[model samples]
Target chain A: MTAPARTTSAAMLDEIRFDAAGLVPVIAQQHDSGEILMMAWMNRDAVAETLATGRVCYWSRSRAALWRKGETSSQVQRLIELRLDCDGDTLLALVDQTGVACHTGRRSCFFRAARDGDWQVIAAVETPPDELYGDR
Target chain B: MTAPARTTSAAMLDEIRFDAAGLVPVIAQQHDSGEILMMAWMNRDAVAETLATGRVCYWSRSRAALWRKGETSSQVQRLIELRLDCDGDTLLALVDQTGVACHTGRRSCFFRAARDGDWQVIAAVETPPDELYGDR
Candidate 1:
């Protein structure tokens, strides 16, 4: 979905409070089900790119560069809405996910639940990791 | 609600990967409505306490102390389920929130939506900050 008219990406960026690492934690939630899919980091450039391209982009700490979601797996996330928290330190991106959102191929990264003193795997992997990234 | 049978809190603790600051980011989501309320940091002690007591607790970065939710505002959050991401770096606490969860008195911290390139205040503050912490 298109961002409603008036505000510009630059103005939106000015409102966020990025951390010392120039990054803000972003949580991606399913637009329809409200299921939280994943949490990632985004830099100013990543946020601007997501807003500009309508595709979610994150700053990969490991790679130390821009990591577009599903770049390898093709499980792209289309931005439905981008939300900034009251404190401007965090973000919530309401998105339309194409497929699974976890590297493990689970629909969500939060597939493990604390139960009876231990974590129980509550959701099964929808696709195997090797399969998702095999061609790459 | 109580944590289910078998696994112990200790085992659960071992599964987590705290940051260099000895903190893990925790996202509190409304159990029934599936609405995301807020995001905060939780130290090992905070996690242990929340699992032990079933009441949400966070590590206040600013105050550098254990922050019990609603301790000041009485907007307590009762833990329904604690979830861990595959990376073991973040947490998702499914909670039954008593009242507003935002310090700004909004139901959620995410009250600002990106619209037409600008941040729009979509939700009104339910209770003024002064009123929520007036007694303190």
Candidate 2:
């Protein structure tokens, strides 16, 4: 879709836009160090919560509720910066994360080995569900 | 944009499809456990690499190259399962990750703390750039 023109200042809220889904693509990054953390979807409420509360909030399609990153496992993400792409359909959220981002107990959920031409399993962290989430 | 109908399966290639960018959204999960890891983008080549070598591979838009997860810091990921959403635009990769996923050295990149109405920096893992990049 060919979008309208974009402005560089926060006063250009008229130019900044979101999709029909009321959701924007958010790219999570590590603050202070400036490292990319992860990418997720956020709606207006999620955006508001993130900005107002400083915690990373995501609209969970599966749960159909607002999901605070690292809620269950005590892992938390603090917001550093909220950036909008030129089109304003995408966002970049610089955050400071805690504990593990992935449910598997690793720092991130992107832990797969790609080598030669095959997808292989390499390393893993976290205890099995039988132990960690047995009650659930 | 409303997408067309697509096939859905979990039998590797039979389950997922990619866009013109040759990339698919991969959701990572912990290996030894069934924790939802982080989500990332992977191109067909990256998928092929992961399947071929058992290592996690991702397309680095910044470096414009193929990135093997944990290639630099000895923090590797092993693929457990590859799942596809009904839309075929998304992929769920079950993996086992080693070491830290975030560059900051924490187990994850999402380490921010949210309290009251403020986002605060909390924990951070320290990693030497040389250890990860090797003077690249």
Candidate 3:
């Protein structure tokens, strides 16, 4: 599908009911496959930049700044669509993900399944973690 | 698919990495169709309770208490499998959802899709808000 329309960041930003911390939770999913890649936080600026650039941006709680996905890992997520829930407190970004979405080198961050009364690693690491973050 | 193994709520709870507020974000999804329902927060007690009992429970930030899904609306979500992301900060609960998941009576809270530079309602409300929250 075509990417979400641009030129409406201001209108879109107004609809988001950001939390007291000025951040909102965002879920990123693989656009074509419908597979959820990861969950992250986005502030007003991050959301605006993503809509402005068609590239996913998030708020790094640790860095306290804008976080562009794949900035260091080269696992960029190109925004295909952006969605807001009924409450406007949450967002869903449909994106075209490159390589693995997990820092652990897994296709997605959700690789561990609760099974047999414990956590089980259900998915294998597609790429080595060292290779993904070798520069860092 | 069969439901996930139970009998280890304590062990499961230990793996969760809740935030400073003692809560973690949980995404609920339709297990059979792979459709995302909604996102909610869960505390340690809520997570344990969900595993102990097959029902999904959330930490209501507003109510400052346990919020059971469908407690009033009867749109329950039965846990099919729970997965933890690689970071242990977020969770994915695959569930067999009954009735509607959104308070607005939409099957999913993600009914609004960004299209043509604005939000578009893609999914119609399956049930009316009055009927869902009438008892309240």
> What are the C-alpha RMSDs, in order, of all predicted structures?
2.8, 12.6, 3.2
Task: Pick the TM-score winner.
Answer: 1
DockQ (C-alpha based) per candidate is 0.72, 0.05, 0.73
**Worst ten in a row by lDDT for model 2 chain A:** A1-10
Top lDDT hit: 1
Ranking by TM-score, best first? 1, 3, 2
lDDT of 2 by residue, A38-87 (tens): 55678776776676666788887668788888667567888766655423
lDDT of 2 by residue, B28-115 (tens): 6565554333556788667656666667788875687888887677888877655443345566666787766666565544444332
Q: How close is candidate 3 to the true structure, as a TM-score?
A: 0.93
| Model 3 regions lying over 4 Å from their true place | A1-5, B1-5
Write one digit per residue (lDDT tens) for candidate 3, span B4-60: 337665767888999999999999988888788999999998887888788898999
Which pairs, if any, clash in model 1? Answer: A4-B116, A7-B117, A7-B118, A8-B117, A116-B4, A117-B7, A117-B8
Where's the lowest-lDDT run of ten residues in candidate 1 chain B? B1-10
**Clashes in each model (backbone N, CA, C under 3 Å)?**
7, 41, 0
Q: Pick the candidate with the highest DockQ.
A: 3
Kindly report which residue stretches of model 1 are placed more than 4 angstroms away from their true locations once superposed: A1-7, B1-7
Encode model 1's per-residue lDDT on A27-110: one tens digit a residue.
999999989999999999899888877889999999999999988999999988999998999999999999899999999999
